[model samples]
Target: MNTLALRLFAIWLVVFGSVGISLASEFFSEAEKTIIQSFGPWPPPLIADPSNSVSQNSEAISLGKKLFSERRLSLGRDLACSDCHAPDQFFTDGTALNSAHGRATRNTPGLLNLRWSSWFGWGGAADSLWAQSIRPLLSKEEMKFTGKKLRELFSEDIALTQKVQELFEISVVDQSDEALFVIVGKLLAAYEETLISGLSEFDRFNVALSASDNIGIESYLATAKRGLKIFIGKGRCNLCHFGPTFTNGEFGDIGVTQFITKGRIDKGRYQGIKALQSSPFNLLGEYNDDQQGTSRVRTEHVTLQHRNWGEFKIPSLRNAVKTAPYMHNGSIETLAGVVEFYSNLDEERLHIRGEKILRTLNLTPQEKKDLVAFLRTL
Candidate 1:
């Protein structure tokens, strides 16, 4: 070859190699690498709706907070909202199953980012926050307070009753306990709307991402980054648990075999849908219709299906690290164990019905570790 051609080829190779090395170096930089490593690299707005209308008023929230701890609202003045949902333990009592004042049929979920939830309970029965409150109050195992008893208690406590009346902007109907129950439910709903947790390490990472601030996010996104990869890839967790709330908000069978042992089985959303449709405390109830307008979105599209047998409400992962004994039945003990359960999933125990949903994730030990590390950061 000619000397001139050889020289030109050598110069081109040097320039190309230099550019490639520079790009590779930037990609693997300490700060850049660490931020990329953090779990759930997505922004907070992607996880939950920050501007939920339920979080608007302070007075309503305060009133709701006060009523939440008050036992007078219950049947025998024995139970309060705090009985099931405790604040110190991330707003959930952290029990596998919650015993109301007596027996509980299901687990107590953490009230972390409930405003983002479209439905309440394991069955997605209640459509609104106010509607969710009524279930426990009337449940046989829960508060078990009725109309007659509630009215008597409200009448006896003049100051408390007056407070309720003033806060709700309506008087308690003299004879029926239904009106008082509705008021208290609404107040409790208002209070629960204020329990949103502030920005965590995950939130900070999102901020860094928006401004392309690589150095600022590196430290916070450590284990979380590694976990995020496992979650999206081998862990296969992102299929059901996909959004900012770490949930697609769809019901799925997570391989809990409680119903299999029982023989008859708890027909999850199927029964729940019928009960919610016929409920008096529902958003479409006469009480709500009279108080609010008829235009409210209540239990409209909620329906029952065969696949909903073991289905439960998909929970938010805001204070997920603190709220232990995961899932609807609280079957899994720790976050690490929960990840392992999904990793080496035993299909034998899973009653998948007609749908081919829960399958063995086939994750390695290191992959499980990475997934657990990521969950703790949430």
Candidate 2:
């Protein structure tokens, strides 16, 4: 024991700490940077929907918020849109399927970032957000109200009807039940469009990386960074889940079972396309707000084929950590389970010929954990 021994130990400690700090300060690799860049900048621009005239109307948004929480919108007066899309849980009721008149055929998706979506619903049945909003109100399985019932309810409430007239400048009493219903849907859509997700940890990371600030990178978890690499590279998750919202807003069939019940097979996009074409509330219909007929293009030219069978909309990954169980059927209970589903994906069950994007990842246990870690940051 001596002064020299103490000095040598102190030098060793300093050297070891310096090495650790250097490792922590390391930047992303060139290949990894390329992949990360593809995800683009975070907090994407707020794009208005041409199909919904009131999409940016403040008064409409206010009315829509009230209508969203109004239980009278449903048949039995037992449920409101808020009942399923609870604001507390990131607008999802945290159920695989919501039960109102009957069990919902699909999971209740979060309402955040609906303004950016080209289509709505798991099957993309509704070509516009307003059209999608009107669907559940008329659906026997959901709100369980006919156009007549909705019109009658509004007609009875003189104050409510008057307010609607003042805000929308439409005579609810004189308008046909269908026309009134469409307006209500449009108002609801206006409010829902405002439910944009806030900035997240990943978003901050992107900001830091873009600024070339070493201290900013410290805000993101190292484990999450590794997972992001896997997501864009080996996991191939970016193929379906790319963009600021971590979704391409397109439909895909990734081998998840399409059966909702023994007798019923949820045909997904195949049935959605058929329903969209037949829908009176569709974007191509007379009710569309777009005078230029530009917004109807997706619905007008949408191709329906056998390949669309069992395909479902790619859910956004933003706030995915909060909304679970996952998938159209809510078949997976946890984010970990979702990762596992893709990890050991059954290639045999997949429409390999139709959707060549999906394949069995065969991710190792560590890789699965890493992918899940990355998703949680979303």
User: Each model's TM-score, in the order given?
Assistant: 0.80, 0.92
Model 1 ranges with Cα > 4 A deviation: 1-55, 289-298, 347-351, 354-358
Task: List model 1 lDDT by residue over 67-142, tens digit each.
Answer: 7887876777888888789888877888888765654656788887676676788887876677788778888788
Looking at candidate 1, what is the lDDT of residue 200? 70
Window of ten residues with lowest summed lDDT in model 1 = 46-55
Clashing pairs in 2: none
Instruction: Go through the candidates in order and give the clash count of each.
Output: 6, 0
For this target, which candidate reaches the highest lDDT against the unseen true structure?
2
Each model's C-alpha lDDT?
0.67, 0.84
CA shift at 78, candidate 1, in angstroms?
2.3
lDDT for each residue of candidate 2 in 1-378, tens digit (9 for 90 to 100): 699998996886587755644654464676677667656575577877777878888988998999999999988887788988899999998988887568788899889988888889999999888999998888888888877778778878887888789877877768887888888999999999899877788877777676655556755788888888889888888888987777888899888888888989999999999999899999878899888888877777898998889889999998999999899999899999999988887776675534677788998888888889999988
RMSD, every candidate, angstroms? 9.2, 4.6
Best by TM-score: 2
